[model samples]
Target chain A: MELLKERIRAEGSVLPGNILKVGSFLNQQMDIALYNEMGKEFARRFSGTKISRIVTIEASGIGLACITAQYFNVPVVFAKKHRSANVSGDLLSATITSYTHQTEYTVILPKAYVRPGDSVLVIDDFLANGCALEGLVSMIVSGGATVAGAGIAIEKGFQGGGDRLRARGVRVESLAIVEALEGPEGIVFRK
Target chain B: MELLKERIRAEGSVLPGNILKVGSFLNQQMDIALYNEMGKEFARRFSGTKISRIVTIEASGIGLACITAQYFNVPVVFAKKHRSANVSGDLLSATITSYTHQTEYTVILPKAYVRPGDSVLVIDDFLANGCALEGLVSMIVSGGATVAGAGIAIEKGFQGGGDRLRARGVRVESLAIVEALEGPEGIVFRK
Candidate 1:
C-alpha cells in the first residue's frame, strides 16, 4: 500500500473536481508488475475469508480483478455497464450513478454466473462516491450470494464512500486512500 | 490452442445471428487457469518478436491483455470506448463500428503510452469484422509504434476479419479459429 501511495504521489495528478488521475499506472496504461504486487497484498489481506468469486465492473476493473483472482484461485465475473436501462429476467441488474461522468448507467451480471451461497469479493480501481460498489453489492445480494467485502486500489476518503460502507459492516480495503488533495501542497494520504 | 478449441466446442454456444457466446469462460466469467495457458501460447507464438507493450480495447480485452502481458513482461495499454467524440490533442482516437452492438463508438488511447520505436502486440477476446483491431493498429501506428502482430483468443474465421488482417501482412495468431458454426452439428474449428 505504501508503494501505491508513493506512486500516486510521484505520478498522480489531481485534476479539478476531485479527480485523481492515476491513468499512468493504475487504470489506462496498466503496470502488471504493480498489479501483481497489489494482488498479493489483496490476497494477504483477505486470506482467511471465503471468497467464492471475484466480481467487478467492466472497463478498468477487469484487469485488476483478473490479476487478483489468480491469487484467490477464483473465477472473475465482471458486470457489464450499459447506457440504457435494458434488463431481463435472466440477468441481475443495478442502476449506478457515476460521480465522474455524472450519468446513470445500468450494470448487469448474468444469473447463471452468480449462484446461491456464493461469497463474492468485489474488486475495483477507484472507490470515490461508492455508487458503483453499492450497485455491485446489491446485484450479489439479489443473486442470493454473500458479500465477501471489497478490495480497492484507491479510495478518495474525502468523498466518504468507503466509510459509509464500513459503517454498514462492509469490509472495504483500499490500498491507497487520499485523505485530502490540496492545490499547492499536493496529495495527502490517510494515515 | 488445443485447450481453447476444446473449451469452445464444449461450452461455446452458437446464439442467433451467428453469435458465438463463449462468455462462460473467455470473457464474462473468466477462467484464470485457461487464460494463463493462452498467455503462454501467445508468448510462444510471438517468442522472438520485439514486443515492448501489449495493447487492447477496454472491458473484455483488459483481462486478457493483462494476463498475457505477464508472460511478455511488458505493460498493457487498453483503449477506452466512449459513446461521444470527446477526444483531445493528447489522445489518439479511432472510430470503430461494433459487429455485435451494431453501434459505432470512439476508442481512445493516450499518446504518452505508445511511444515511437515501441513494438506493440495487440490482444483482444474476439475478432469479427476487424474494425476494432484495425482502429487499434492505426492508433499504434499514429504514435509511431510498430505492430508486432496480434494475439487473439478466438477468431471467427468465417467472419473474415483475421484473414483480412493476415492478407495485409500482419501476423495474427488466434488460439482458436472457428471455421463454421453449424447449429445442429455444433461449432467447427480450423485445422
Candidate 2:
C-alpha cells in the first residue's frame, strides 16, 4: 500500500470532479511490476481464505484480477459488459450503471464457471460509486458462491461504496482509501 | 498449445456461425493456470525479440496481456474501449467494427505509453477479423513505435485475420490455429 500510494503521488494526476487519473500506470497502461506487488499484498491480506475463483467486471478489472489470481492460484471470472455471440450455457447477468461512462450496461458470466458453494474473491482497479462491484456481487450470489473478499487498488472513501459493502458483512480491503480530494489540494486518506 | 487445444476441445462449445465458445476458460472465466502456461509459451515464441511493452485491446485482452507481460519482464498497456473522467492527456483513438456486437466503437490509449522507438508486442484472446489487432498496430505506429510481433491464443484460420497480419510481415504466433470446424465433424487444426 505504501508503494501504491507513492506511485500515485508520483504519477497520478488530479483532475476536476475529484478524479484521480492513474492511466500512466494503473488503468490505461499497466505497470506489471506494481501489479505483482499489489497481487502479493492481496494474497497476504486474504491469506487462508481458500479462494476458488476471482470475479471482476471488464475492462479495467481484467488485468488486475488476472495478475492477482496468480498469487491465489485460482481462476478469474469477469462479467462482460456487452453481449458476445460465443457465450453459451446458463449465465448470471446483472445490469449496472457505469459511473464513468454514465451509461447502463449488463455484466454477464457463465453459470458453469461459478457454481454452488464456490468461494469467489472480487478484484478491480478502482471503486467509486461501486456499481461495478455491486453487479459482480450479485452475479456471484446468483451462482451460489461466497464472496471471500474484495480487493481494490484505489477506493474513493468519500463515495461510501466500500463502507456500504462492509456494512453488509462483505470483507472489503482497499490499498489506498481516499477520504477526500480537491483541485490543487491533492488527496486526503482516511486516518 | 496442446493443453490449450485439449481444453478448447473439451469445454469449448460449437455455436452457430463458426463460433467456438471457450468463455469457460479463456475469456469470461479465465484459468490462470492455463493462462500462465500460455504466457510461458508466448515468452518462448518471442524470446528472440526485445519486447519493451505488451499492447492489447480492452476487455478480454487485458488478462492475457498482463500475464504474458510477466514472462517478458515488461509493462502492459491496454487500450480503452470506453471513455472516462480518468482518461486525460492527448490520446490515439482508433475506430473498430465488432462483428460479434455488430457495431462500431473507438479504442483509446494515452500517447505517453507507446512512445517513439518503443517495441510493442500485441496479445489478444482471439483473432477473427484482425480489426482489433489492426487498431492496436495503428496506435503503435501512430506513436512511432515498432511492433515486434503478435501473440494470439486462438486464430480462426478460416477468417483470415492471422494470415492477413502475417502477409503484412508481422510475426504472429497462434497457439492453436483452427483450420476448419463444422458441427459434429469437430475442429481440425493446421499442424
Candidate 3:
C-alpha cells in the first residue's frame, strides 16, 4: 500500500469536485507491475477467505480484477455497463449511478457465472461513493453467491463509501485510502 | 493456440449475425490461466521484436493487454472510448466503429503515453473488421510511435480484418483464426 500511496503522491493530482486523477499510472495508462503487487496484497489480505470467482466492472476495474484473479487462481467476471447482443441468457442486474460519468446505467452479469455456494471477491480501481461496488455485490448476492469481500486499489475515505460498506459488514480492503484531498496542501493518507 | 481453439469449439456459440460469443472464458468471464498461456504465446510470436509498450482499447481489451504486457515486461496503455474529467492534457484520437455493437465511438490516448521512439504492440480480445485495431494503429502512428504489430486473441478471418491488416504490411499475430463458422458443422480454424 505504501508503494501505491507513494505513486499517488508522486503522480496523482486533485481535480475539482473531489476527483483524484491517477490516470498516468492507474486506470487509463496501467502499470502491470504495480497491479501485480496490489494483486498480491489482495491475496494476502483475503488469504483465508474462499474465493471462487473475482468480479469487477468494465473499463477500469477489468485490468486490476484480472491481475488479482491470478493470485486467487479464479476466473474474473466483469459486470457489463450495458447489455450487449453477445451477452445472452438470464442475467442478474443492478442499476448504478456513476460517480465520474454522473449517469445511471444498468450493470449486469450472466446468471450462469455466479451460482449458489460460490464465493465471489469484487475488485475495482477506485471506490469513491461505492455505487459500482455495491452494484456488483448486489448482482453476486442475487445469483445466490457469497460476498467474500471487495478489494479496491484506491478509496476516497473522505467520501465515506468504504466506511459505509464496512458498516454493512462487507470486508472492503482498499490498498490506499485517501483521508483528505486538501488542495495545494496535498493528499492525506489514512494511517 | 490449441487450448484456445478447443475452448472456442466447446463453448463459443455463433450468433445470428456472425457474432461468436466466447464470453464464457474470453471477455465477460475471463480465465486467467488461459490468458497466461495466450500471453506466453504472444510473447513467443512477437519474440525478437522490440516492444516498448502494449496498447489496447478499453473494456474487453484491457485484460488481454495487461496479461500480454507481462510477457513483454512493458506497461499497458488502453485507449479510452470517451473523454472523462480524469483524463487531462493533449491526447491523440481516432474514430472506431464497433463490429459487434454497430456503434461508432472515438478512442483517445494521452500523447504522453506514446512518444516518438515508443514501439507499441496493439492487443485486443476480438478482431472482426479491423476497425478498432486500425483506429488504435492510427492513434499510435499519430503520436509518432512505431506500430510493433498487433497481438489478437481471436481473429475472425472470415470477416477479413486480420487479413486486411496483414495485407497492409502489419505483422498481425492471432492466437486462433476462425476461417469459417458453419451453422451445424461447427466452427473451423485456419491452419
User: Number of the top candidate by DockQ?
Assistant: 3
Worst 10 residues of 2 chain A by lDDT: A182-191
lDDT of 3 by residue, A48-161 (tens): 999999999998999999999999999999989898879899999999988888889998899989989999999999999988888888889889999999999999998889
Cα lDDT tens digits, model 2, A105-177, are 9878888888999999999999998888888898899889889899999999999999998898989999999
Interface quality of candidate 2 as DockQ: 0.82
By DockQ, highest first, what's the ranking? 3, 2, 1
- Checking candidate 3 for backbone clashes, the offending pairs are none
Query: For each candidate, what is the lDDT?
Result: 0.90, 0.88, 0.92
Write the residue-wise lDDT of candidate 1 on B33-135 in tens digits.
9999999999999998899999999878889999999999999999999732222338888999988878889989989999999999999999988999999
Candidates 1 and 2, the one with greater DockQ: 2
Tens-digit lDDT track of model 1 for A12-52: 88777777888889988999999999999999999999999
Per-candidate interface DockQ score? 0.58, 0.82, 0.88
Interface RMSD over true interface Cα atoms for each candidate? 3.7, 1.1, 0.8
Which scores greater on TM-score, model 1 or model 3?
Answer: 3
Full-model lDDT, candidate 2: 0.88
lDDT measured at residue A77 in model 2 versus the true structure, 0 to 100: 84
For model 2, the superposed segments whose C-alpha errors exceed 4 Å read none
Clashing pairs counted in every model = 0, 0, 0
Best of the candidates, TM-score: 3
